[model samples]
Target: MKMKTAVLMAAVLAGGAACFAAGAAELAKVENWPRWRGPQDNGSTEAGRYPVKWSGTENVLWKAELPGKGCSTPIVWEQRIYVTAPVAGQDALLAFDWAGKALWQTTVGAEKPGKHRNGSGCNPSPTTDGVSLFATFKSGNLAAFDFTGKVLWRTNLVEKYGRDTLYWDYGISPVLTEKFVVVTMMHQGESWLAAWDKRTGALGWKVARNYKTPVENDHSYATPIVVRQAGAEVLLVWGAEHVTAHAAATGEVLWSVGDFNPGGQKNWVAVSSPVLAADVLVVPYGRGARLHGVKLGGSGDVTATHRLWKREDTGTFVPTPAAYKGKVYLVRDRGEVECLDPVSGKTEWTGQLPKSGANYYSSPAIADGKVYAAREDGVVFVARVEGKFEVLSENNMGERVIAAPVPVGNRLLLRGERTLFCIAAQ
Candidate 1:
């Protein structure tokens, strides 16, 4: 009778495990843009269709005028949309509902206004893990809030660490991993990468990320990315003349690639973040004609051997590359778009996007077999991700746009200079 009871208990536990696995799989299919670069952190989404054509009035579902200006992209989770703005001399994180109603706005820290021409205090994008939202500002403040707008915890990195000395304002967006909110603070003075507990805002680990580069070249506005390799997850931090991978659990430097800024140009700042495609990781350097493709699963400096390929004359200056469906899409600062093979770094196609009197700071968003590249002067050129460089539509938002468009479900969220416009099918 005792043996029979043990068998029945084992069967019950097995059934419970199966149910939990199924629930996790179902949750992954919910389609939520929860972070700086969407769910995958590569500026691409599987949410499928998004409206290709939108004007100032046509196909725009709703437009909410923000209090002040921001260049960070809006992130969405379930029915809530969160964005950061510098309003009334404060760095504020605003929340909105699905129907474009303002839910709540909370002041996170004092605004350290950008000194550069196109920079802002709220340049870093906020990231969410569905339960809590994390935001960072140029003031070096990091805050966390629950989905219902309750402030859970807040801390200022500048208070703990030293002052940031970047040429422009700090713009590296926070990355939320399963266990921590990882942040890379690379600048001219006392650079480091630190991770904090997402729930309690406690420091989990910190590592000094000093790089032996020129003063101006030490500044990096690129964000860190998380990638999975060999059944283990690794966090990648790009900038400071190298691309370093850290162990996601302990903040240990696993490997690095340093040939990106070989000649040590004083003005070579890393603006674009690394994008991972399958087993290859593409790292872009500013003012360079080539981008490096490093193969994953290495221990030390893999610059000599692990490099799969390098594409000359094909690097982006400001916009980060997007990888989708085995192809990497790059939008240059001067309105040029190139699609290259991820493994070999071979150019598949290249063409110029529609000019809007300015350059591009926003990265390309790939969804529904289309690549959406937004220009600084408020024009978004939607092109097909197929044979040839065919443009499907040219969308004009009629305002200065610097943030990448967020695609969720059948709608696209575009944050311009003063308004957040939601575009959907008419």
Candidate 2:
């Protein structure tokens, strides 16, 4: 199951360029979901006219049955949709046409089954820079591919840096910057943030990000968010009970904030990632019960200086909060939805969806002021978060969903347990 130094990527191609995909002139105007958090690195896509009501049979433009189980969210560039899945027990990346047809399938290597019931070997979503795309598996294998589904290069992190010590499966996806594709490893031991050359797969930089925390608190499933501050790229990482900012170019720790667990709580691993609302950074901690708001920028040890506001009553455990129009929208695991002012940490409004025994692991997404959320039992809900919180619709997909709902141009994409569905306004 080990990938050789010079990786072997075999792609089975189909329809080319996903024909009639992106209009040539409008291509520059189109808002493609290049990464998991979307084009803006937040869950909101202000350009799309997503479906407000949809079901397994209704409003579905096309539905493609997936070849294997995957929880990774699909990323779209133009009309080409890229997702990771295990095809015949091998870790592979699959491409689909805009018409919901398989474009190509490329095998990376053997799959690493998840330890959690809802986990998978393809938890990390694929990221693309329009020209080339990047994907990483739980096996620590990261590979890059061309838009035609040809493997450009491959590298195995676990093979180079040794195995991860996280309690559960790796959940962080690869993030693309101007010149590098960066990834992070946050665990009880040997935590680090590293970047590699986007074109040649060469090691660009690696920075140690280890921290001490209570037992099991060091294990983090949260994904790092990339943002720009002071006109330069910076990475906001949440893990090991600390929030740190790193120089995206040289992998240098510019500033750090800690003391998240003041009471020394144990087993409070970070799963829900940090989200940025304007210039304020919102972090969910206290195992989904507490939330924090911090002001962006400053030098080393901004723990006391950048601290803004915090909430002790409510937070989310699994679903990363989404920010739109400078407000934070959080869909708690148990169905409680809260919209807050990111700068002041003030609760603007709160609402709840239909009570379900199942929880929400998919991060909520916002499109044109509407919040799209998915429950584990396959029920997707749309809530309007403008003047007040209002439940718009609860559509059932008839399967499980752990990936975040993605709203691309003129359509909303939902990746179910065994299928990929595209919903459009009709």
The total of clashing pairs for model 2 equals: 0
Query: How do the residues 1-426 of candidate 1 rate in per-residue lDDT, one tens digit apiece?
Result: 011010000000000010112234433443678877888777887655678787766777788888887788898887678999877889889997766778899997799876654567788888887778999887988999987778899999889897887656678888977899988887777789899999999999999998878756777878887887676678988778788889988889899877766566566777777788876888887453669898876888988888888766779767788888778888877778888888878888888877655777777888888888777778888888766778889887877777888877667888886788877775
Cα lDDT, all candidates: 0.77, 0.81
Clashing pairs in 1: none
Model 2 lDDT tens row, 1-426: 121111000000000112234456644555689888888777887785778997645788778888787788889887788898888988888988777778799998888877666777788889988779899998888999998878999988889999888666788888888899999888878889999999999999998888888887887877787888989999988889888898999999999888889999887778888888868889998767999998878999989989898889988777888888878888887889988889889898889988877877788889978999888888999988888788999999888888888988777889886888888766
What CA RMSD would candidate 2 show? 5.9
Q: Considering every candidate listed, which one attains the maximal lDDT?
A: 2
Model 1 per-residue lDDT at 262: 59
Each model's Cα RMSD: 13.0, 5.9
What number of clashing residue pairs does each candidate have, in the order they appear?
Answer: 0, 0
